[model samples]
Target chain A: MTGGLVYLLYVLFAVGGIALYLAMPRTQGAHAKAGLVIGGGAVAGLLALCAQVYMAPHGSNIFYYIFAGVALLAAGRVVTHPNPTYSAVYFALVVLSVAVLLVMQRAEFLAVALVIIYAGAILVTYAFVIMLAQQSGGGSSADQRAREPMLAIIASFVVMGTIAGRVSDLRELPNSPVEVQATADVMDVPLADTPVKDAGNTLSVGRTMFNQYVVVVQLAGLLLLVAMVGAIAVSRKRIPADEHGPPPPPPGEIGRTVPPF
Target chain B: MLLAFTQLGFSSILALVILGIILGMVAYSIYFERKIAGWVQDRYGPNRVGLPTLVGDLLPEKYGKFHFWGLGQPIADGLKFFLKEDIIPSHVDKPLFLIAPCVSLIVALIGFVVIPWGGQVAIFGQVFNVQVANPDIGLLYILGVGSMGVYGVVLGGWASNNKYSVYGAVRATAQMLSYEIPMGVAIMCVVLTCGQVRLEEIMASQVAGWNVWNLFYHPVAFIILWITMFAETNRTPFDLAECEQELVGGFHTEYSAMKFAMFFLAEYAHMITGCAFLAVLFCGGWDPIPFVRIPLFRPEDTGIIAMLAKMAVLFGKVAFFMFMYMWVRWTVPRFRFDQLMRVAWKGLIPASLGVLAVAIAGLYLGLHRTLWFTLPGNVAVVLVSLWVMSRAKDPVSGREANLPPLTRSPELGVQA
Candidate 1:
């Protein structure tokens, strides 16, 4: 990446980290309004910079900008909102925005699947848990306080910067014939915007998944099955305290119990 | 207006027309629901609310005296909702409370965009679909939108700051989550049988063959979908969420005026959409007759008159389902919450899975569309499920055995 762009990225990340730290709820108080303004500006600036550098080749799409903005803003809310229920709702908004962005890329199957699995199913379960668990109006003290905000912000930003730097450097590479051949060799089919036809992207995706990546898909299903089994095993364990005692130990102290199974 | 509509395409025009039609249907469904309830209970419903006196005076005596079978009631009710005091409870989440009804109504309304209401139509030498958007994943689109409908209930209940509202919302969340599995599996059965995800293609499959509907192939799935539809729409006997005897007014208890009206409109809209989905998936979407395609009702007949006739047929099926909704609402008593859960988990889910398995096996054997293969398979599934239910040892309607036994109590002499 160029020195100027690198410097801008640094500035943006620094401002955003500070904004998130300020916005995160604390025991005393939080400057949420100020944090929101600063964070929004930082995010917008970062998006603009990315657009200028990466998306300059493709003409600017209004929908792309709008949905991306919404995704980023709602993602911010999901992290920084004090109310867990509202956080879950904001996460749904983020899923919706991302789904729209996927649609803009002509990944219609992925877009609808994302909406179905994330916004429709997972977020509903999240809202269910948050609503039932959070009896208070605003939020619990755990939700009202950020744990090690500085360390998390720094670690996440560092990783993000590294990835962004690597992507930009790769994008800056010369489009040599050898490089194109390598890309074709790796992908089998060259990456291009194939105009969607009668069967649409769904057929293409399903064919590729089942034909080429069948093993990977089966492995993913196996992983999910293992996770399900693990969850069932964990939940089936009957701790003595849970059945007969007054009340199970509070949340943090639950590690004290040993699983009989 | 004509020029604008031409520029926007027929799909946009159809969308506007469908929106108007659905809103009107939603209004009248409320009237019909009350009328049906009244009929079931041997009492008069809203027959007295005729035309307003001001409008009545302006008309001729003959026309003014006409009651129009209480057709003016929905209009009056709409006006009442508009003029009624819009009350937002003080101790509530203001933003969420305001957004919930709109979310509910919008999600309910948008699901119809993918339903092929009248198949293809020929207009001004151009062939166009009656549906607003014919996405490849049309069935999945409907399922996704229907799944999103639960958010409104949960949000409204949470925002109401009432215990009953919370209970109602919790029940709604759990119920929707439970019933969606069976509904999705049932739809998958249709998809496997047809080998298509597009609603129009699926409709064409039933129309092009022996002209038999998917319901004939998978009656068990149809029955499962029918039961889940009531649960998904939070209707009786699955409407444990808003059972008046327990939770007063349920999730919308604290809502007043237009907000309450919006929730009511959403429920009716959801019913209409669910009915349309059922018609599209199992019944021939726009075919008037299932086993026999009449002359003008064939899929190939794309004339304007034919299109209108097909639309009427689709609406007829939808209306029948809507009537059934009201019929079941008044006839069948509400299930207890535990019973509702039992019906979904033990009854619908297992039965739907069986139907899905039969579909897959039929597809594998290249007899997915044949009556000989699918019909017997569906019947067998029903018989097996019945046998299993008969053999089950546990009572269906009682406290769950999974719950921890009562703790030891010295005074009460109860043991763990």
Candidate 2:
């Protein structure tokens, strides 16, 4: 019943989830059903986000909640799902939606940068893992790194859960952020129409963040530069087990094992 | 939650309404892109679609050449995407793939929040502001959201479980990221020079004057930003993702029907935002010219003509950039993968830092305030940038294919 488009998004996906659930075969297929569960759960999660977003007033930071929440769900799927490829992709999406959330919060510049960096470079690194890092044994159709991701998800959930109470608690949209943040909850009393006294100080602090705090920004830049270079350097060509299929031909034993036309 | 409608006064509500109107305008933007593209490619475009001929009426003439081609096309296209089946590949990491496009489109929509679209306006009785959010961190918002196109492509590609799609996603993500550094630096120069981050304030600060058209101020930075824009938008030459000759369908290959359309729609939406931001930063943003200095036509007045005029000029500038995108796409060829990286990291990064260094040096030396031989020192910085570009090595080259297959990209047989 809200204006944030909750019903349109919720109802649309609710129908899709139900349809997908019903479409599942009676035979309990691990991968397929795992897929349906992960997918249906995500749709449900998205619906929740849409509902929240729809219910939100303009300028509300509820969009951040929606973004971070859905991102958690996305990252969750990559861990729970059976396929490594799907996991990689879903994991990438988790970072991307943050960019979206940032943009919606009027951080388009950072949003774009996040997209290029996390979604672009980081995802490529993941892609390389899938391509080059096959195990000694022939990896199955299902992702063999299932345990690693499962542990990661659990570890991540624990980390997030500790912060969840405060994080999920809606961050307020303060008009004058600097002064407002300092006074917002310290006294447990809201300021109604009382304009903060030191507007100039807030501007000065903000300017300092860009200028005097330039070193941290420079460090951030360096870290990203390192990431770019590191990704490229690490992704060098190595002898792939998949390229030369299974049975151990001795190193000197070449001819028959090679791709013979 | 619907408190926005109930609790908030008219201005915020008016902002919401304007947001909706702009979105609707963006929906019709497809018609704009296609119409422009058609013109650029020497075609008639959607002229056959009649001008709303009683508001989106078609289906009476399916096969006819002018079956409401001009007016009804965007409508028809909009309907087609909505009505089409939403396909979800079984192999995809189902949840993320489903969410990526929406996330992308939403982020794309969000950038307009900080943009002072119609400058400002007044409603029935009380004054209503046009922009949705005028945060202290307004310009940063552009950098934040404008870059989220990577997610849409990456997720779509990664989730699809197709090799080509994944490859495309990776390439797109990498290209976007690589270009963003210089792009960020270039815009920083613009914002830093202006001395305000808030959109409204930035526009107001330019009352004295705009910053050198910026393209002229830092030519190398300007050129780098332009190239980054092209790469950022996944336009041709930088359109390595969807390169049919290489990676088929790029990130959206596995997506079909409405889901596929979401990716398609998101790309264009993001493209428009790219153009909008470009216009906002360099081409005087909402300031048509610095010294309009009219007393009656004040900064945030509600005169219909002035608002319309400002909107028209801003809209015109964005459209010109869009046209340039199409023109460049048609004129240029795609860059090779290494070539693309070489340009962004090797060329743009060093050059951008050089520009930033000059700016910082100028500030410390107090050269910025000083006008040399009647020209501002910043103007001199701009001229020097042009000279450096003239001397810089041109990216693509003179001769071809003399190298042995052992050298660069042994996969493609180039000199390593």
Candidate 3:
């Protein structure tokens, strides 16, 4: 019956959150509204998932906390109200909720990352834009661009769909029966012999990541670094004049550069 | 073969349904945020869709009749994005730009695979893990997968081929990476306390009493967590990416049609994911089920009913935080860029370090293993954080500063 009560509450909050989103302001279209609904609803759903642990901690339901917590706090401003400022606060709450939940899960690293990466970094940027948005400048004025290309966009979406579909379909690789065996191996080892259990019971990817999975973690880091470097290199450019870009430097400045001619 | 192909046997199906439901909720979140903004700001929101179009007589007298904004507004909005002009400006870096939002969206969607939504469900005389993919590495995997999203933002901003986008990109990366330090510190406190990283075990350990509410145990850490989470999600005063006053859509300015929609969609996904994370970490995931005495409904049953109940609790918590996001956005103004940076560097980082320090102290003192201590410290931190929020300056322009001229345009300077 408690489960039913829980669902009842979930329904109420989900509706309330959606109602809140629906009650916001927008001039351009429904995307904002829909986005808020989807975002707010997901957060509401994730929160409900966490409430279960609070209702009964001893009941074997803790495992769900980690993932639920990770997802819960993801919503920043899509719920609550439409104002970007409101969204930012909601976003912060999402981060806080995730952080607290992760702490509870003992996934210290992940919890911190949620706060650091999502709350700290992402939300900060969001607040910057929302605050900086011009009160009068036309953000949606470009809707009138004529004869817009369609095929390429469709193709891009298709590619995304296919790749996503493939990733989703990868269940065929079949998780190694060994994953379970590994769990058993850890369980069977003498308490004294088991390094992880003795080390605060924190069986982190960090630990094994440093031990067995060190190479994997290092490789992923390397890839991210490479991407960052490439992004910096590619994004840098001198603005051009009359070439349909940000206005360029004044005429006399170009020739002052090392007298190449 | 199909049964065997599942990620976690019978639970995979359940996981998908739950995830789908969550995604649907995310869509609605966008709708409501707008509606509430209209009402709070004293404007009618999307009641246009709920209007009776057939008679056309109910149209607002402004349009010559009383009308309800269509209830179908959100749906129409979604369809419009899909069918709208899809354009990628010629100057953009095509590959990464195209890939960015999708990557972010997929990553956000995938984070759900490991969450213990229903805990465990018994099937075919065997109890199966009620998660999509409960890898032994688990919690770490979430960190690994979750952070992949930042790349999407960075890449999207950079690829848009606009100075504003690039600026937003740089700020985003800096903001995200800088705050990561304190976030990491705060997390260490939790780890020190729990002594375990496995999601299941962590939850199991909390069975004694909702983890004694982590805030009370590690008050300093809680403060750090709240601050860092704000920076991480890029909401509010921090939302510099699309600052129309300056950046003109920031990273997504050039995007048109469904592509733009994808960016927004991924954002909502990120928000939901963040909220769930908070619910699980602080509030106690799925343990809010009220007292139950029925023989089959024992806390030990770990049955479908239990799973549903747990989902309900977690979901509610997640929604509350989501709602809080909107409430806050309206209530608080943006922080000036420098102020935002200071919070990361001077404010949150140090506070997080303090949390780390106390965590280590308590660790050596065996606080997690023992507990009921540090209550006073937590109260102090909470008071301090509340005080800080109250005193923190708005981002558009700090409370202490003269509003800068609009045209000098430092890009971030808020014109008075």
Best by DockQ: 1
In candidate 1 chain B, what residue range of length 10 has the lowest lDDT sum? Answer: B397-406
Query: How much of the real interface does each model capture, measured as fnat?
Result: 0.44, 0.11, 0.04
Error of 2 at B165 (Å): 1.3
Better of 1 and 2 by lDDT: 1
On a 0 to 1 TM-score scale, where does candidate 1 land against the true structure? Answer: 0.88
| Candidate 1 residue runs with Cα over 4 Å from true position | A1-3, A55-58, A137-140, A169-197, A233-261, B1-8, B52-66, B397-416
Q: Candidate 2: which stretches are off by over 4 Å?
A: A1-261, B1-29, B32-38, B51-69, B82-93, B122-128, B209-220, B290-305, B366-416
TM-score of chain A of each: 0.77, 0.49, 0.48
User: Global CA lDDT of candidate 2, please?
Assistant: 0.62
TM-score (chain A only) of candidate 1: 0.77
Write one digit per residue (lDDT tens) for candidate 3, span B1-416.
34564435465577668678777777778777787778778987776665335455745567664334555666778888988878878887687688778866786777776666545665555676666665554565555555555656766776675778877776776677776678767766766777655666555555444335454567677666656666666777677656667788777778888888877877777777767765555555666642223343233676666667767777887788788777666667877577678778767776676666666766787765444556655555567767877797654423222322224333545354
Tens digit of lDDT per residue, candidate 2, span A2-76?
A: 344434444444443443343333323435455456566655655565456445543256666666667756755
C-alpha local distance difference test of each model:
0.85, 0.62, 0.60
What does candidate 1's lDDT look like per residue over B146-171, in tens digits? 99999999999999988999999999
Best candidate according to TM-score: 1
**lDDT for position A223 in model 2:** 100
Q: Which ranking of candidates, highest TM-score first?
A: 1, 2, 3
Candidates by DockQ, descending order: 1, 2, 3
DockQ of each: 0.28, 0.09, 0.03
Alpha carbon RMSD to native, model 2: 11.2
RMSD of each: 7.5, 11.2, 19.7
Model 2: how many Å of interface RMSD? 11.9
